[model samples]
Target: MTSARRTAVAAGVLFLITEVSAIAGLALYQPALTDAGYLGGAGADGRVLLGGLCELVLVAAVIGTAVTLYPVIRRRHESLALAHVAGRILEAALIAVGIVSVLSLVTLRQDGAAAGADEGALVAVGQVLVAVHDWTFLLGPSVVLGVNSLVLAYLVYRSELAPRPIAVLGLVGGPLVTASAVAVLFGLYGPAAHAISALPVFAWEVSFAVYLIAKGFKVFPVADRTVTAGGMRPELSVA
Candidate 1:
């Protein structure tokens, strides 16, 4: 109904899109990411390209969520809202880099196979591209998302933009995931532990998206002004 309500729903949809695209991209990338000889064969080039496409969609959606929420959050705190947008932009940029790396790897595979290029060299190059993608995933989604979630959660919590439980999830999840990512950077957490740590943040985002979609936003009440003999104008009240 209201513009603010529409914005919340749109942001939710974008968040959902990000999740879907990220999952689809990763699933489609498995052949090149896991198999050492994937680049040698011509079977899965299309699959990897499709994966790259999904990631491009993900990049768009990632930025969309930030942009959609920017106006609402900026009203509460302009600087932090800017930080949220900046963090999401960085994440999207990193995701774009990863997409490019994968696409280049696909090109390498296709051309190398056709030209009778050295299989060893092609595979090595492919692995390097995959490594680039992995780094981007780590830095972009894991690290940057944590900070973005914190900023968003703080704004929502203070402003009552969403339910308190959802905001609390972000508050707790943000620090946990960020710390987990840092530990992963330092080789302190293995794959399983890292995944476990990321669950909280994932839960936060999922719940946030669902709530925004289902309920839009919790409307805060503003003060009603009245005119009298001695007019005393009051500032708008926030809930």
Candidate 2:
């Protein structure tokens, strides 16, 4: 296994981690997110804390994918590779902000419950925190994801880093997701619309991750040199 192939595998693993953690975190948070009295309810603390921790892992994994892929993809296009890294970082930061909001809500719930404060006020605060989290989700995964995916897909397509089919998924999905986000922002559609739009990008990432792990990358001849699909010189590239 060459270093570049190893890096590709690592990136794939990180992508899987991000996906699993995001789903699990959201699942763990569902009770608190939906229940009006979760702040004062029994066992809410544990659920919220677990959810927050999962989200933290998700943030790390998100950044990890970008960092691991940077070296491989940058060979084809430095600026776009850097932009993908920056976009992933911004996504992680937004997710972290959302985590903070949730944690703060948890703290408020605990304190308010102990102090016998107004339940209405606690509920209101919780609602605001959830709203903040939702917005971050929109901006981070929806908007930022679109840009990052498009950048990556372009690099992959141009360099034949992975299969063209996988790259095409990203190309198609990125715009769909961004458009869906716009619709949501403008109140033209609901969660169902957003969910439908997210499917393509979701497919792209999952398929790409699997491909990278199982096959690494392809090879191509460029100009006077033979390079790996990711655009690294043949001697430097490994699969």
For every model in order, what is the number of clashing pairs?
0, 0
Error of 1 at 62 (Å): 0.8
State the lDDT of candidate 1 residue by residue for 1-239, as single tens digits: 87767887898999889988999998998888888877887558778889988998999999999999887777677799899999999999988988898888878888888899988888788889999988888888888888888889998898787899999999999888888888999998675787788888888888889999899878543444667678965444564
Cα lDDT tens digits, model 2, 38-142, are 887863778878999999999999999999988777777778889999999999999998888878887887788899989888888889999998898888888
Q: Please list the residue runs of candidate 1 whose C-alpha ends up more than 4 Å from where it truly belongs after superposition.
A: 220-236
So what's the TM-score on candidate 1?
0.91
| Candidate 2, residue 94: how far the Cα is off, in Å | 0.7
